[model samples]
Target: MAATLDGLITFFASHHAIRADKVLRDAGFATELASGPKELSPNCGTALRFELSRTDDALAVLADRHVQVDEVHPYVPRTDAWDRSGSPVRRAKRLWGRRS
Candidate 1:
């Protein structure tokens, strides 16, 4: 199967990470600049999270923007309610019908 873009992309520097975030956003992609998971890399403290299916497009935009990337990890974190399935927010959502 082809690779899914449902993963996190690390940067060589925080500035590049920030720029990539902006570039993707400007390109009409919903992305978030999240703390770099130490296990993923120690090169920068920022990582950009976006829809995995759009990884190729996101990477293309980053390259066009000259954003230095350390790595593109095929990581798919728990998306449903996260680790705390019983947290207040999760609980409320579950109570209201949203399981995630």
Candidate 2:
């Protein structure tokens, strides 16, 4: 089977991740940028993932767009579902400083 969560990009900065996502999508590549799992990157909270077969193309596009990506990984997030409902503020308060 092809890589489901294929060309995952781990970026040093969230801005690069966000902009890369947009640029890829505009270029007709299905792409997404998300909060990098803490296990994957402690310095950055954002990353991008796209079709694995397009790794080279993706990198080229990002460079052309002037997005400074830190690293790229073969990542597949655990879940595809998203909570459109904003996370509750109470959860943030309760979990503040609890993360390692």
Candidate 3:
């Protein structure tokens, strides 16, 4: 089953991000390697994208493999006016549509 790319995983290093992509993929999770958003994390130049719904499983898998993560965020890039900037505009709404 393929999952939507709706979550962002930030890491302190590019190695961790890359390893996360591989680990998640190998564990049957959908993942993507993307340029790290500076506003979210300034430590690395890379980030891992994954399905927000599978966050718990993903994090557990990473933890079992001893992979360190800086943070996990539910991200839905604003598509209206900020889409062209290549930088995502975060909304106040949470990933599950509940108010944050």
Candidate 4:
């Protein structure tokens, strides 16, 4: 919560996600590990949340650290709304959001 985390960085694998989190943290960037947004990607279960303005620098750091990234998405999760409504509504939304 130190930065305006408007970006979501996804990975093809969980290891990559974990590594990216560590690497970014070590580089002094604010980050959070969360479930990859279903609307953005389905390859990995984990994703890194950070500020969008520092995306280029973050990507550079990841590259230097040898972390492979699946994609970078501009995402501002509705966590406050979820918190206010609680998990029941969030869970219901997730369940009803299914295709079949």
> lDDT for every model?
0.76, 0.74, 0.84, 0.85
TM-scores of the models, in the given order?
0.67, 0.67, 0.76, 0.74
Clashes of each: 2, 0, 0, 0
Model 3 CA deviation exceeding 4 Å by range? 78-80, 83-100
Q: List, residue by residue over 1-100, the lDDT tens digit for candidate 3.
A: 5578999999999999999999999999989998887777889889899999999999999999999999998875646534434443333223337745
Error of 3 at 97 (Å): 28
lDDT of 3 at 30: 85
Across residues 1-100, which tens digit of lDDT does each residue of candidate 2 receive?
Answer: 4335576788877887888889988998888767786666777888887888888888898899888887777765454232233334545555675978
Better of 2 and 4 by lDDT: 4
Predicted candidate 1 versus true structure: per-residue lDDT over 70-98, tens digit per residue: 98876555445543532456666667795
Which should have the higher TM-score, number 1 or number 4? 4
Candidate number that wins on TM-score, 1 or 3: 3
Q: Write the candidate numbers in order of decreasing lDDT.
A: 4, 3, 1, 2
Best TM-score goes to which candidate? 3
**Which ranges of candidate 2 are over 4 A from the true structure?**
1-3, 79-100
Instruction: Name the lDDT value of residue 8 in candidate 4.
Output: 94
Q: What residue runs in model 4 are displaced by over 4 Å at the alpha carbon?
A: 78-100
**Candidate 4's residue-wise lDDT over 13-41, tens digit each?**
98999999999999999899988865566
Scored against the true structure, residue 41 in model 1 reaches a CA lDDT of 79
| lDDT score for residue 78 of model 3 | 49
